[model samples]
Target: MPNWGEWAALAGGVPVTEERDPARDAARIEQLDPAYHHHDPSVPERIWDWIGEQLDKALGSVGVPASGISTVLLFVLVLVVLAGLLWWRLGAPRRAAGRAVALFGSGGPAGADEHRAAAAGHAAAGRWTEAVREQLRALIRGLEERTLLDVRPGRTADEAAAEAGRVLPEHAEALRRAARTFDDVVYGEHTADAGAYQALLDLDRAVTASRPTLAGSTS
Candidate 1:
């Protein structure tokens, strides 16, 4: 019921009435107001906390330890950092070819050895398009040096392949294919890869070793 005195009064003829404080009720409403709730987080805080919660739920489902989750997050952050560093060092991967003109550009005429060296460098750097172009250049230049094909100014890839094919009849098809790859990378607005580069390199070696036969010769 109540304390001894209150119980005694209740047992007697006295009645008790509950009292309300209007000031206290107004203060409670003020405490619940959003603008006055300084302890609550802002929008950015809510977003960041939501991301962390999602990550925890995902990783926890895989039975990752709470500490291990941090480690995994740090590892992913490191990979992203390393990618940024690589882009800074080697530049971004291009969707289009280099801005140079096709087939030897405007530079002075380079020897077969020079072109081959350039192709090797590009291959090492994972620039397959440039590598393929340079290797094809080396193939044509080497044949010219060997007197298997004439070195004519302003000669195109198709013309060079046709002329060389006539002299090196056994490799005519290969030479034509190599020329097409060269044109695709350099002028036809296409890309190349490691396999294409390797093909051109093999063609160059084969053409260098083979003896040239005159056009229409049975030999």
Candidate 2:
């Protein structure tokens, strides 16, 4: 092999150089303008598109068109929303009625007056839970005494509220709330205060004072 300087001398003495053009580089950079670049879709748009794509795939599997699937889905969604609203508005009475059937056992108060006296005694001692229980009992017994509620075995507080609500429409809300309070204290193991006891007492008094409405009337 020839030596390094001898090889260079043997060949034409050519100096290597790198050629750069600022104008050409600038033109290349301008061609890559961010303003003209395509942007990824927004998060919500992407999600909606993904959902539509999935729906299309699913519908296509069943030989359904995407447009028809959209219409059907919209209808079903509207129906579900309306059903939820209706349930929110009208489900209370039915739930209260169901809860009532499970509130108490076979034995109940002998008389409304006796229960009232017991409730008063409990209130005097500041035993609000007992007071609430006895007052609710008084209300139930009072209804039974006046033949407002049938003498059914294993009556529950919620049941009594429902039955009395039928008889006394004006106190229906109060009756329902009072029954819930009683259940909270007894079954739910919640502590009752004076306010709870007073509410039940007021409900009892209202039920006793109100005259029963005609049968099968729920206003």
- Identify the candidate with maximal lDDT: 1
Clashing pairs in 2: 100-159
Residue-level lDDT of model 2, residues 1-219, one tens digit each, is 866766786686765445799999999999799765568687899998998889889989999976798897798899999998876544545455455544434565468898889888989999888888888888887888788888775777777788889878889999988887887677544688899988788777777888888877564
| lDDT of each residue in 1-219, candidate 1, tens digit only | 488877887889788766789999999989889888687898999998999889999999999987788899899999999998876544344422343234556674389999999999999999998889889989998988888777775677777888899888889999988877776676545579999999999999999999889657775
Q: Which sections of candidate 1 miss by over 4 Å?
A: 1-102, 215-218
Q: Backbone clashes per model, in order?
A: 0, 1
Error of 2 at 130 (Å): 1.1
Question: All candidates' TM-scores?
Answer: 0.51, 0.51
Pairs in steric clash, model 1 = none
